[model samples]
Target: MSKKNKKHEPHEEHNDESWLLPYSDLMTLLLALFIVLYGMSTLDAKKFEELSQAFNAALTGGVSVLDQSTINGKTKNTPTKEQDNQNTSTLTAQNMTQLQKRNELRKQEEEDLEKLKKQLDQYIKQSGLTSQLATKLNQSQLLITISDNALFPSGSALVKPEASALAKALSGMLQKFPDYEILISGHTDNVPIDNDQFASNWDLSFARARNFMEILLQNNKLDPKMFSPIGYGEYHPVADNNTEVGRAKNRRVEISIIRKYQDPDSQVTITP
Candidate 1:
């Protein structure tokens, strides 16, 4: 009985620290939440994209557009064919402007050429030499024929002293134009020459051409380089060889003014 009583009377002192267990558990939970938030903030974009795609595949039914694609929050549209046509039209307008300018310049040049031709015709008519002198117009040149009696002496190569006034009148008109080429040619009748000074018609015809060329060259107003002289001794006959009237016409000098253009009006091309 004494042993049992001693065992029961033996008592232990209790320490109370139960609140620390719950507090430790709360701190551990807060630490875990902060770590999860940090992981979300520093997420890898590529892996995150793959994870989001897998999530959408598991849930969504429609193909949705990417979030960042809607820049300026506007709907995208395709370019129209009309815009391309307008660009082409602008280019065409620029080309047309250049063409118009070229066309205007060409017109101006042709007008100048026509006026020159008219001036030459006027001078020929006003000099009262229209009958003996004739003008032949064509695409290549303008030919003016003056009789031998008007330009030179019989069987002589010398250009007459009085011819200078006539040549000056012609040269003064021609000096203003440098764009054309001038040719003075001499021709003779079929009859043979019997002069002591020259042996044949060829010599006389050539001398006549040379003398006329010299006269034109001496004119300070005319350009010497554009003038050329040629002789045809009864070879290039313009009229019948039988009649005296034809022979007189054949034995003459001719002046040619070459044309610079085919026509007064024509189309022009322009490039940029």
Candidate 2:
């Protein structure tokens, strides 16, 4: 019985599946790499140390990798509240020093003005010109008041020759205060006058102020820029216009030494 010659059937080869194990292992490693990179990118210093400590605990039974980086047993670059307060105190001290300097300068100015006033009063007493000349110091200025009869003739704008001496003396006194500004102001009584020399009190008062200012400017040491002339015709009177004595007081020339320093309360701020 020749079993119909055993047909040698060829066995089919099966595809090998062993490579899947390594592929899955590679995928897991890549995922772990991506997670580590993401954690590194977002971690702050404190959180980064915490994460490192966790890794250390898992790997080495709780030894920390960040233990050596701590300095002076504290975090670096963090200022305490006391340090901020010290900075503020330094600024306050500087402001107080500046305020003291300003106050000292103000006091010095007051002393200088008082000395000038006393000197002017002494001159008026010595020259027996108290009735004709007077000095008054107020908040805005030191004013030297001269009577119309002392400086000019009736109905005249021209300064009298005798008054030149007085003007020269005043210029000499004013030379000591080169930084001050001088204003020459003329005032007239309410009486109306029409004459060949002047048509109105305005014209007369302005001319008188200008002429007197010219005398004051004769000193070569005086700065012309520091002086000004103004005329108030029958206006800004210090006395009543109805009486002769008041009229005489009203008709006068004033030399005002304007104060360079102004009081804080009276100061005006001009906005542009």
Candidate number achieving the greatest lDDT relative to the actual structure = 2
lDDT of 1: 0.71
Error of 2 at 8 (Å): 20
Point out where model 2 deviates above 4 Å.
1-91, 267-272
State candidate 1's TM-score. Answer: 0.55
Judging by TM-score against the true structure, name the best candidate.
2
TM-score of each model, paired residue for residue: 0.55, 0.67
lDDT against the true structure, each candidate: 0.71, 0.80
Task: Give the lDDT of residue 12 in candidate 1.
Answer: 84
Clashes of 1: 0
Indicate the TM-score of model 2: 0.67
lDDT of 1 by residue, 1-272 (tens): 46664555557877898999989988976775575445445544444344445544644644434322222332223233576699889999999999788778656555655676677678778888776677665545666778898888888889899888877877777787777788788889999999798788888888898888788777787788888888878888888879999899888888877655545552221100
Candidate 2, 101-209: lDDT as tens digits: 8778767777777888898899889988999988887766788898999999999988999999988988888888888888888889999867887888888888889
Count of clashing residue pairs in every prediction: 0, 0
List the pairs of residues colliding in candidate 2. Answer: none
